[model samples]
Every structure is written in C-alpha cells, then in structure tokens.
Target chain A: MSRLKVLLPSARHLVTEELARGVVERYDEAAVGEHTVDFERRLDLGGFDDAVSAVMASHDAGDLSMDGAMAEAVHRQLRLSRREAADPGIWRYLAIVHRPEVVRHRWEYRSFATMRTRFWRHGTRFDANAFSRWWWVAELTVMAEDYSLTHRALGSSALSTHLFSRQLAWHHPTVAACVRILADAPGADVERTLRVLGKMLGLRVAEAMGREELEGLVRAARG
Target chain B: MDDFGTDGLTGGEDEDGTHFRALCKDTLFSNKREEGAGGSYGLGKSVLWIFSSFSTVLFRSTLLETQGLGNPRLIGRTELGSHALGPKRAFQGPGWFGEETKQRRGTRAESVWGPAAAEISGALGFQARNDHDTGTSICVVGFKDPTADADLGPVELARATRAALAEYFWPSMALPTRALTARTEAAGQEVEVRPHDADVAPFVTAWESYLRGEVPAKAPLTKPGDMTVVEVPITIPRTHGGEPEVKGRVALVVRLAAKSSEPRAGQVAFFRGPGMVVSYRDRSRLALGMRPFHAVLACGRGRWPRKPTESDLAVESFLRMSEPPAHDRWEPTPRLKAHYRRGYAKALTELSRRVDEALKELLIATHVMGERGPERLQRRFPIGKAGSPGKGRSAFGMSGLDARPQDGAWSFSGAIERKAGEGPWSVQVRLAEVDEAGRRTEEVAIEALSVTVDAEVVVEGSVASVTVPADVRVVPFRGTSAPCSFTGALELELAGRMVAG
Candidate 1:
C-alpha cells in the first residue's frame, strides 16, 4: 500500500466543482431561488450533470450490478466510454461504491429500508454521485480484458468480493474462481480433487476451454 | 428534532461584540447574460451556506457584451432558518428546521459572522483566498460538520476519508495526499495514485502456492513468464580463417535441492538451440519439470523460432556443459549414505563441483548474498580414531575384565594401580583384526594388558583421584597415586555408545 496521504482538501474542491455543475443542471439560477422567475433563460448543462444523468440512466437500464450499470452510466455521461475509462485511477471511486460485495446485497433482494439502514456501512455513497459509483464498480469487478467472464461469475456480487488486501483487488476472475471451487469442494477429497484439477488444468488439453465451459464444469461439480 | 435554543447555538464571541463574518464567493451567476456559460447557475452559491452560517458572498463578473451598469451583486443571506436538504431528506421548500443553512450569504460583517467562519474553517481545515480581479470569494463561518455521518475513531475516520477521495475525485484532487490538518505538519504531504495496468493475478497465484508449501525452493524468484537468454560464444578462433566458428547454441540449466518426499530428480539439465525451434522443442516436453524450465530458457533466447535438433553437436556440447561432472559428493547423513550405491560417494563428489558452478551463476544474477560465499568445491570428509571390538586386557597382570554388546547395549571393566606423584597415562586395549576382511577379530579384555605406571595416583580413603589435563583425550576416571601401591577394579556400564576418542 502506498503510504497514507490526505485528499480531503482535494476532495472538497472536486466536490465543489461537481456540485456547482449539478446545481446548474438541476435548477435555473439566473432568477435566484425561484426556478420559474426566468424560465426562458435556461443555461446549457455542463458535463458534470450529463455525467450524473448518464449514470442514473445506466442504473435504470440493466440488472447488471446496479453499481456496474451506474458506472457505465457515468462513463457514458462523462464521454469517457471510448477512452481508457477502465484504468484503475479513473475507476477507484466507482469500485468503492459498486464493489462486488456491496452489489451482492442489492442482488439478494434486500429491502430499501434495510439497505438504507446499512447505508452508513454500505452503498450510501451511490446516491451522492452515480458516475463516481459506476467507475468504482467496474474497477472492482473486472480484473482484465476478459471482463465478460468476471461479469458472468460475479453477476451482482461485485461489492461482496473482498479484496485480498484493501489495496489489491486485481486478480483474474477465472483463476480466482478456479481456486475458490477447489477450496470449497467437499470432504478430505478436496486435496485429491485439487490435485486432479491441477494436473488437468496444467495439461495442454484443457487450455482451450472458454470461461463458460469452465463455469459449466464448476456448476456440474457443485451439483 | 428538539431545538437547543440559540444559547449554545451561535459560534464564539468577536472582539467588538459583533459576530465575525467571512466573505463567500458564488461561482454561480444570477444574470441571464451569463447563463449560457458552464458555471452561470447560482447553485454553487448555496454550498457556501452549506459550509457556513455567517458569511459574505462576493459576486464578480467580466461580461463580454454589456447591457448592464451595476454588474449586479445579489449578496444575500440564507441563514440558519433557510431552506436546506436534510441528511436523509430532499430539498423541496424553505423552512426553519435549522439542520443546515444551505446557501445563506449575508451583506457584510454582522454580530455573528467572525465566529462562524472560524468554526467552519477549523472543521474543514481549509483557508480561503480571494482573487480580486474577476473570480468570486465566499468566506464562511460557523460551518457545519461535513463528516457528521462518520462514526470512526480519529485515525479510522482519516483512513475512510482518504479511501473515498482516492476512489472518487482522484483526477482533479488538488491535494493528492490524504492529510488531516493536524498531521500535515509532522508527516509532510503525499499523493497516492492507483496503478495504471497492474496485473495482480500472478502475485495472488504465487502467494497461494507459498501457503500450500508447494512453492519450489527456486519458485520465489518466479516472475512474469518472459523469454530471456544468456549468450555464450561457440567459436574458438584458429589461425586458419576458413570459418572461425559461426555456430553457437543457448542452453538452460535448473538446480533443485533433494527433498524428503521424493529424491530430487538428480540435477537435471536440458540442451537446446543452434537451429532449435518449436517442433524440436516438443521432444523434450515429455520430461516433467524440464519443459517449463526449457520454455523459460527458449523465451529468453530472443525471437528464436524453432527448437534445436538433438543431433546438433554444438547444442549437445552446450547441454553437456550444463550438467555437473560425474564425481561431486554432497555430504549426507549416515541413513542417506546407506541408501546410495557403494561407489555413489565418489560420483556425488564430482556432481557437487558442477552444482557449485551452476549456483555461482544464480548468485551472480540475483546478488542473493554477497560474493565469496561458502564454496562447496573445497570441502573435505571427516576422519577419527575407531573404537574397540573389545576383549579382556591385562593391566600389571591383573585380569578378569569383559566388555560385550547385547540387545544394542554393552559394558566395560578394568583395573588400575595407584602410585605416588606421577601423572595418569591412558592405554589402548581393543580387538585387532587378524583377518583380511576384518572379520577374525578378538578383544584384549585381559590379554596384552600391563601395569605401565605413568601417574602418581593418590588414594583418598576408598577411591584414588588423578588430575588429568583439560586437553587430555580420555573418558573420566578416578584416583591419583599415593605412596603405597594399591590395586582396584573399575566397572563401567555402556549402552551401545561409540567411542570416538
């Protein structure tokens, strides 16, 4: 972990800029507190509002972890959809909010009240800024280019996935799942099963199996 | 919520009995002429109130086209009774609920402004500066707690705040490091940027392997699989320049320590290169543990396409060079030596030399330990005197001593003479081999024993005491000689102890 550093002042500044943009998009400020004072003098909305709106839209679009959808929404909103948006630096905020572990709580169908009660310790940050939330969601869920497999496996459990260390959440999902399956297999045979799997996987024969096939094997074995 | 009346509600007292007021700036504009710009909305102005109660907001603008005279300033106050979005509620109407003063900008210094700015600035640990030319300034006092939701201790709260900022506003973070006002002085400032393309998958795999103890002794050095090579010249130039030595081959060697569960696959080495490429590499793939090591070597050889053929003489020579000479020996425990062939010791001695050369290469590359570490090549085997295949021995013609082994145990007995003022001298009484195979041996338990007087043995009452030098090599014995000649028998119970002295 990099040594502890404070970013509160930076946070305050960034949040200020964002909130300023948000206020312009949500309300008409030319006539002061009254929104209807000069309805015709509507201002052009800034990228910040567009970002928030995009995040909200993405959240509305899919049952992909609400966080993932939120992140995509933010990416689209920020016009970073075609850029290096998945880069760790850009997506840290989204990961914090839409982590697989947190997403699991949403997916398991918990009540809004229970969810809200857990907000102080859970997804409360999602309400403040969807773009930031979505970025973080994607970061925590996808470890590599093969995010399709990670998406299938994690489904909505993105936030539920604990980091090996709070700082290190980057590992291939397939490798992680393979390890997990071996770890969870029944009885003292777990070692034997792991040995078999290791030998099989180590061989060139099973190298061609795609993620779906791998997941299928896991499911069949679990059954 | 019950109201705690204005008694403890206002901040602190000011110098002239007037509340300290701070100047606040709203980047949000109030005019339609400025509405088309990205930051024209006055919502930014409300954040000042969200921060402080007694504040003064300065509205400054530089318009491109002027239809106005006053550059109009709408400096106003949205006080403690103003409309606010609650912690868990949305903002719909104005009320005196007093949870927060969302955007209350006052005109000038009032009886409540100074203390309010101090309170808010202290909580946020920030300072405000005004740019008098064009931008705005929104000074605040009595600012509300931005982190009221936090339940963490001081340290944890700081950590949580840092984590959040690092995750969210990282790109535009003015202060890159997460620093609390109190700590910034002693620790200095810092910035933490997340890695761009970190592949943590390899680290995790390596870690798990370590926990399982499946980590090979050489495994800790595992790095991302990459093809690398160390080049060695194949040609020895001769006087006739017909073709100095155009051919060269790259070879790889691996050394693994012997283990208890399985005997180490004897220091295996594989040869490749000198026209070697893919299909040929397949031939060696059948050798377990050899393939990965080969793959690693081939990858190091830089863009080399195909595997080398077995018939390639230079390649064969390179491979042969990688193997240890046939006579190195690494000392083994007695049990290990028993498992090897009688002639294995000589062969191991040769192998030990080659292994030393290979380890030397690794040491150079890794700088694991400094140069001049212990060399296994210059080692020697241990030598010592052999103990008795004992028999009864005569000491001054005194006989009747027996030492024998039974059920893995044995015993010894003898006689000594006491004389005055002479030092103790030890005698050898052991069975000597009388046959070629050393099988026909008999003990000197009583025969060939004599009374060779060496020490002045002193008799003290029933037992005799002798002083032996500290460096003397003998099992401890009692009695120094007195002025009288005294004879006594010594008895010892030995349970299969080997006598190396």
Candidate 2:
C-alpha cells in the first residue's frame, strides 16, 4: 500500500477555511492528473484572482477616472509606472491582515486572495498595507462601484498619507470623500483646508460622525 | 548580501576609465549655486550607497556647467584591503571607505526626468539641459527582483532609499503643495504646491467680523434665557446607570438658538455651576465635557419639552461646578462627591453618548497601530491607562513581575495573579524570595493588585508569605525552608461589593 503525505502550509500562507475547502473540492483524482501539479492551475484561488481581475477590468468600463487616480497613487507612493501600477486586479493576491484572528483565519485556507480580502476588511490589519506604497494604491484606489471619489482620494498625498493616518480615517467612507474635495485645492490651500478640517474634526471625529455625516464630509472634501 | 562589483567599470584604467569611474561616483560632483542650493554635496548620495548597494547619480543643476540636460552618471571606485594577499581584494565595494574625491559624470538622459523631478521638487521646475549650472538629481541603482517586481509587490529598494534620504539630509524636505493653485493641460493636469503656514488675515478678519456682528456684552450662550424652573426625572442608560437610578436635579433657565458668527451653530450654556457659565459647542469631534459649557448644553438639551430630569439636572449642574474653571478659581481638592456630583453625573450622560464611539475608534486603532515595541509598552505602562493606580507613583521603577518598597531596597517576586483575560496584574507584595545577600523573609502587601495588560492567574498553591529578619542577608538559603507567614494568602475571591447596583 502507498502512504499518503500531508503538506504543511507556510508561515506566510494565507487563506480562509471556506476558501481552502472550495479550492480543494474543485480537484478530483481524474481532473488532477498528477499530485505534483500546482494547485492554483487546477482550481481558482477561490475566486481571488477572479475578483482582482474583475476589479481592474472595470476601471476602463466603470470609471476611467478612478483608474487614473490609482495610477497616480502608484506613481507617487510606489514610484511605479502608472500604466502598470493602476491595475486593481493585482490587490486580490495581497491580503491586509490586521489582527492575529485574521492571520489565524487566513491560515485555514489555501487561497491568497481570500486572505487578502479578510485582511483588508479590518482597520488594524488593513492600515499597514496602506503604508506600503504599492499595496496602498491598490487597496484604497480600487472602488466597489463609484470610482470618482476613490480616484480623487488617491491623488492627494496629504489626504492619502497624513489625513488617512489620523484617528478619523477609520471612517474610510468619509476619508475617501474628504480627500476627493481637498485634492482640487492648490498645495497651500489643500494644506490649509486639511489643517482646518483636522483641527475642527479633532480626534476620533470619523467614529463620532454618522455614516450620513461622513458622506457629507466626503462631499464637502471633494470641493 | 554578497552581490558585489556588478557596476560598469569592469575593465582597467584609461581616460575613459577615469571618466567612467568619475561618472560612477556617489556625490552630485558640482552643485555650488549662488541662490538657494537645491542639491547636496553628494554626501547624501554616498549614504544611500552605503545603506543600499546602488551606485548611480542623475542630476541637472543651474549652478554647474551642465544645467539643463538631465544626464545619468555612473560614479564609483574599487579599493584594496590590507588583509588581502593580492593588491586588490574581490570588490570591497563602491563608496565603502567614505566620499569618493574623483567623480565621473555620466552622459545618459531620459525625457521623463524633468517631470519626475518636478513632481517631488518643492521649488522651480528647472528642466535638465546639462549646463553645469545649479540644482541636483540622483538615482541609486536598483536591484532587479523579478518576483517582487512583477506587480511592484514591495519596493524594498525605494523604501531603503527614502530611509537613506531622511537619515543623511540635514534640512527637512518640505513636501510640494497644490491646494491653492490650478493648472490645466491638454492631456494631463499639472501638479502644484501650497504653503502650510497659517493665512493670518482670514483668521483675524473672521474673528473681527464675529465680534463686530454681535458685541453681545452678555457673552453668547452664557446667559440663561426664558428657562422654566421645573424638576424632572431621568433614566441614565444601563451602561452608565449608577447605583442610584434617580440622582438629583437643579432648576435653571435653558436657552437654544441658531445664530450668526459662530462656527458650530447650536450652542447651549448654563449659569448656575461653580463658574458663572457652562457651554457645549458641537464641533466635528465629540466634546462630551470638553468644557463645562458643552456638558451644560448637552444636559440642557437632553431635558427638552419638559422640566429637567434628575440625571440631566445632576449631570448638568455637576459638570458645570466640577469642571475646574480656567482661572484656577474652582477650589482645589474639592470633595469627590462634590466633584462627582457633577463629574460623575456629567460622566454618566457623556459616557451614554460618547462611550460607544470612543470604544469603536479605540478598538480599530489599537488593531491598526500594529505591534508596538516592548520599550514603548514599558514606557507607556507608567503613564497610560495601565498605570491608573499606584497612588500616583507615575513610574514603577522595577520591570519585574511585581515589586514593593520597604526597609531600604525594592523587592522582587515571582508570585503573580493573572486573571482570565484581565492582565498580568501588578501587586505591591513583599517577596518570599530573598534579597541580594542570604537572609530571612518579610511579608507585606502595600497596595491592591492593579491589572494592566490582562487578567492574571491566581497561582493557587504557590501563594506563600515569608518573614524577613532585619539583620540577616536577603539571599535565598539552601537546605533551609522559610515557613509561610502572612496575614493572608494570595487568592482570587469575590468581595462583598457588587459593581452593578
């Protein structure tokens, strides 16, 4: 009788249980010709790549402006070529793990994309990813539907780095809009606006503001 | 780490070799300008090479003869080591010893150089036309990691370069601003910069306009208007609902209005507290009791449509009186109840509204801030929420499991109480363990255990007390057992007090 070997995952290996199971279930003895074949080839990384590809693909169809915004961010933060850096599809592969709980959950699956999403969902885990220039553009630049706000949010360095680092940024929805409006101001005006807004908002204003209020702030910021 | 000697000067010494070597040098070569010197003396460039093994300089200076043309230069040298058998050792590397005196400037140029430089430059966007006049531009050679570079996975090289720039540069680089300017282009918009300093005129003008509009000799929001004097009952939330459901009330006039000149329109004030007035100004952030004014205003607002509720009145009046006025007029060492009457009441009402928001933000930020260094935790332990107690000790000098002061020296202990999830609580307990020299034991529990990081364990069987004899050395004695000797043993037990009333 032949002995079956169990493969242990890597320390950096990130995936959720559901994703890993979905990926594993897709493979069968007949379909998976050889045991040595790469698992990614046989199954989707639990729609990780699909999700990323879909997001990037939509930039042209959804909001070209958003694509431009993300590209600018890539150029600023990562200093990468805008054409290559603006792709939203690339984010799916990189997970933003905020907590030990998220890391634990990621290890349960084999899909990198699932890990990335779960990581990105939490503020703590999601924030560090934003500090990394390349990943930051990919994370904040990619929008769910409306790319205009997201693009504008990405273009402003103060909005992206300083404002986002503030206590209020957890109010991401608000943060996204605030940057958009402020992005239009001259460098001096933008700085002044941000400083004033910062002072008025004080600390933890985002959390204090209602979802509606945050959206209002965002609208105000886009001026 | 050993990826050395992969530069252009592969062959030997020639005028071309000298020129090529000069090109590979780390410094900007000649950046002596008349006005504001934009570039450094290649010192920063040298530091960049030391940290990250990259040897390339790109520049366009108005001070140098080569001002406009954005030329890429390769400048470096290969030095010999005394320990080596041969004259020259296997590439001891570029910019290894210090600043390379002989610099060779490269003649390569790229079109995007001007725009790229302009984006980061806070000053004039001088195009590179190679006229050795002034300014500077340098690019450290980058490592090609196909795997990471595939999608700009992580710009390790760029981060290192940024770090290098920050460390070596003397003056802080001001980021270019674009907030107040507008630029239009056929294809793409141009970036602009703005100053961060205050616009003095607008601030002063706004203040003057405000004063001129309403010279309200009677300070705005301070005077109590047609406030009906009536008593009302209130129910503080369960979260903040103290032992007494109904606290107390105060009968005072209340006023609410929308006015001109103010930043936040809605303003409420109280006149009966310790000070003459209490106000609550609603800014973007939560101002629970930021000032007595806010608390009074919130309390006044809460007790609307009817007379003031017991909780509202108590909190309103408490916050008014409890808040130490600006002039240090509020009596020092005021009774806790006197203070709590307002402080606690105000706290309850404010907590009712602000606690949840604070909690959410706190939790999210805590998770996001990432792992802080142990040193930071240690530093914060004395001043942060963790060090709430200790009778205002400020800093607990010892960093052991626990420590207590007595006799002359501070004592250490292994006995600790770790609650389920509370923290490694710090207790002021006398040690069963001995002092530096051999000695007997002494028992003392100076203060109650204060939990910091988490709830701690109640090491059930390990709890023991020792009596330290005055004259004996404090060191652990071998072959000799110290009998348990204390008023009580360390254990987790419920007291008669109940937190929830």
Candidate 3:
C-alpha cells in the first residue's frame, strides 16, 4: 500500500471569503475533488460511509454500546487501508465533502465561526475535526482485540475528548487500560480525574509506570 | 507581598478636604469640556452595588487634618435602597459607621448608624490609621458571585481576575508614575499587577516599543496647521466639487503574528483625549495583506471645545459625538460616521502602504542571507521575455519589480522557440551584476552553461530543425560555484532575442 499524497492549498485560499461563505452551503463533491490533490490508493469512501451509517443507526436505536465499537471499527479499517487518512486535510475533505450533512446535524446550533472550525485542521484536538476524532480516540484508547474497554473509557464524553484530543499517549496501551478502568469505576468523577491525570502527565512521572503502577497512581489520585 | 501602598482612591479628595463630599455622591459628573470631570459617567461605582448581594459597601476612610492638630477622622458609610417596600418606608442606604458626635446632624444624623467606625474596622480585621495615614478602603458585604456559571475555582478566578485587570488597565499601569495601584490577593498571598506582568507583557512591550520609535512612526501631514497630521490622499466623491481632502495622524505598532485560534494579532484602537481607547477595530476590517499591525488615531485635545456648541458637538473629538453609553466603543451618528469614515479610510490606507514597504525590505534582507538563498531570491525579481524594456512582470502580474537588490545571485529560465521550417535556435544566458542601488556595476558573461532543447538538432546550410522530445532540460544551470554576492539579472537569448525569467 502506498501513502496518500494530499497537497495543501495555498494559505491565501484557505481564508478567502468564498471559502468562509461556502462552509454553510450544500456540499459540492466535484468542487471538493477539484481542490483536493489527486493521489493513488484513496480511502474507500463507500465503506467509510457505510460504517458511519451503521454508527448513526445504532445511535438512533438508543444502543449506546455501539459508539466506541463503531469508532474502533473505523479506526481499524482506516489504519489498515490508507493510514495517511490521519492527515488533517484528508479528514477535512471527508467531513466537508463526503458527509457534510452529518457535520451540520452535529453542529447545528454552533455559530458560523465555530462551524467553520470543524472543517479546518486545528492543533492536537482531534475532536476539532468531526470524523478524525473518532478514529484518533479509538486508536488511542482501544485495547488490542478488546474494544469493550474502549467503549467503557469513551462512555464519559469529557474524559474521551480530553484524553484523545489533548493528553493521552497512543503508544501506551497499559495507560489506556488503566484509565479505562478508572473511568468505568462506579460513581467516578471522570472530569476531575482527567484533570488530575492531565496535570500529573505534564509532570512526566507516569512515563515509566506499568499497568499496575498506573492503577495504583489512579487509586492514590482519587484519594 | 508587602503593602507598597498606593496614592489610594483619591478622585475627589483634596488636602483641605473641602470637596470630599464629591466622593460620597453618586451622580453624573462632567467638566467644562464635557469630559468626565471626576469619573466618567459616575456609574462605574454602581457595578459594586449591583454585584453586592446585599446592595451595600462598607466605605472607610482616614482624612488628613487641615486645621489645628487633632486625631484624624475615621468614617464608614453604607448606601442601600428599600425598593421592595413602599415609598414611606424607603430608607437612604447611607449610614455613618463611626464615632457619634453632635456635629453629625441633618442628613448625616438621619443616615448615621452602627457602632463606632474603629470598633467595626477592628472587628472586620481592617486597620484603623491615625492622623498620618490618609486613604479610603471599602469592604463589599455579601459580595455577589461574578462567575456563578463559569464554574471557576478560586485559583482560576484569581488568574482570570489578574488577566482582566492587566488587559483593561495596562495603559495606566504602563505609565512611569501611575495614578493608581492594583493588587490581587490569592491563597493568602498578594501579588501586584503591573504592565510587564506575565498576563500583559506583550501589550506593554508593544506600547514601549511604539514610544521609543522602534516601531513605525506616525507619518506627519503636509498641511500647515498647529494640529499634527498624517494625511492619506483618497478619492471619495465630494458634494461641493472635487474630492475633499481628509487629514489625520495614524501611529502603527506591529506585533508578532498570532495563529487563528489565538487572540487577535492586530487592531486599530481609536482614542479621544487623555489616551482613553474609545474603540478597538480588529485587523480583519482593514484587510491589509501584511502581518499583524496595530494602528491608533487619537483626536487631538485641542480639537475639542471647552464648552460644547452645535459645531463643537459635530466635531469627531467631541465627547458625546461617538461614545456609546459604556464608553467602550465609538458608534458615530450618521453625520459623524461620514466624517469618521473619511479620516479612517485615509489612516488605514497610509498604514497599509507603510506595512507593504517594510515587508519588502524585510523580504529582501531575509532572502539574501537565508538557506538556499539563491533560489529564494528569484521570487523577488520579476520574470519576463527578454528585450521587453523597463521591469518585468511579477508572479501575480499586479506590478513590476521596482529594483532588484545587488547582493545576491540571480537565476533565470526560459524556452527556445523555433519557427516552423525556419531553423533550430541557439541560446545564450547573459548576466548583468548591478551595485547595491541596482545601477549596472558590472556586466559579467556566463562562465558556464548547460543547455538542452526539446528537439534533435539538425544544421543544414545554417537552416536547422528538430522534432521536440518528451524529456528535455531546457536552459539548466548546473550548480554555479561563483561567489554568492554576484547580484544582478540573468537574460536568456534565443535566436538573438532576449528572454527573462
């Protein structure tokens, strides 16, 4: 498999009044394709849409468990085929062109200034891009072959957004598992716990900690 | 932190204490110039009353004795309203929480309440100073929670308060001798807020740099008058005849560029007299194509009349002309807006021109000395076909390059055109090295060249032609080892016709 080569538009074109105005207009797939740099081995847009449909269906059916499972599935699929879809512009194109209705539905109440930001590449915050955040969160928190833990961890919206967007290390599966355990603990104040964890992570003490050590740290932190 | 102390809230105080009543009243005050005499609008203090859950503030003061030697008078007052009750039951909020005396009569007698001020001050952990000390302090009782919905903890609230004070009062704080001092107490530690503090260092730095003329200076207008001016010529339609000339001074200060998510990188802060900012217009409105730059256009104090007449009120500097109730912005009336727009248009145009010139100079300096510097230098010079005289067209085709700097190497590229059934063309690249001012300093010939054409060469009795090929390296310069300072233009001659890139 070859990496996707997405060319960036000039900086001037990004902030043009036309682009700002176009964000609210109906999606034009052809215009998006014209602006996007062509490359071989693109992500399977059909399959991606099917996955999104399945997730939205689950959400409609009130089956809350499907949220993290869907995120994990999408991440696993994209990471296998065209892992370079992680690049911001590719995801931006997917959100704005491939599934703009979903973007609008999710951010209907947001101001135009905020709605426009959902289409751009902001620093570090995966949630800044509506579609990429799901993949990134799953990639960061999912234990190998057991997405049950990912679901439990992502149960708390604040915890999931903060961990995936700002704080968590994707490479440390043990830390992810420990945080998942802490998140699912009965009556856990996930927001406060994440805030504490965020502060501790800044101090770099958890870098060498194993799963057991991290569990102990979480327990002590709660105390 | 130590109580370095301040001049205190002395807006209405005098050494003789004759006008001390001004401090106790809550009414709109304006001077002859119609500018805020003691305090602007006199409604700012009401924010405390509104923010106090009990609608009361315990005001304490130690006044300096002006006459015979006597103990300084310490007084306390509270102002409240009984709006819930009938008018007959309504009570004036004022109450004297001080020593009882026969002299406290009339309104003072009617309003005075509570025990001696010293006892109350001591109970509240407030210091009661003697004759030597003279300043006022207030303890807001039942203070309302300002950030009720913000969910901010004590630490967050402290940080936010520090930042807010820094941003709003930075101009006053930046002065060498400030009229007031502000401090914040958090976690039992008091920290003084200053202009150079972490929260507001950038604003302070920009302000200081502006004062020192390290940033761009305000351009002066040519018109003869006592008023300083920086006129920008504009072509707005005039009712009388030709375009009416609008004049103004615009001072600009450029700051480091900020990312989109960060706070605004640039703005134009308009001010009236006393350097109070009336409005802050963001850079997005100006649409200047340069990096973040701040501009200021303050109406001269002399422009405002001492007593506002009809004509005086029409002037842009008149206090009531454009100021909103909050005094935070200038939303001019239609007539005043027209005059303001004329002046503002001129100021912005002038600022944009200066920014463009500065950027060009910076680009030349950076490109000349940066890595891969020779390649980067090409973007500055114009590219065109040779023998086209004057200057060549820029990349965007907006304007031609004024003069290429003579401190860097030049690179040129062009194609060899062969007329059908005519002949194959021979090409030579020429170099002209100019001095710092772009005057032809030396005409240097190409020491080495690598030329490749799209077609095969055929010379039959000086009439040659070849079919263009798929792969060709047309007029490639195989790395020049010449000295880097060889600055000038490179011209490509195809079939004895000069072409430029």
Lowest summed lDDT over 10 consecutive residues: which window, candidate 3 chain B? B363-372
Model 2, chain B: what is the TM-score? Answer: 0.19
Looking at model 3, the pairs that clash are B79-B93, B80-B93, B221-B229, B230-B248, B386-B498, B386-B499, B454-B469
RMSD of each: 39.0, 36.7, 24.0
**Model 2, span B272-306: residue lDDT tens:** 32122223223323322121111122232233313
lDDT-best of 1 and 2: 2
TM-score of each prediction? 0.17, 0.19, 0.40
**In model 2, which runs have C-alpha deviations exceeding 4 angstroms?**
A1-47, A50-147, A187-192, A203-223, B1-501
Q: Highest TM-score among the candidates is held by which one? A: 3
Better of 1 and 3 by lDDT: 3
Instruction: Give the range of the ten consecutive residues with the poorest summed lDDT in model 1 chain A.
Output: A1-10
Interface RMSD (Cα, Å) for model 3: 26.5
> Worst lDDT window (10 residues) for model 1 chain B?
B376-385
DockQ metric for all predictions? 0.00, 0.00, 0.01
**TM-score of candidate 3 versus the correct structure, residues matched by position:** 0.40
Cα lDDT tens digits, model 3, A40-135, are: 465555666676676766564334455575667567666543355546666666565556555554444335565566656543353366666656
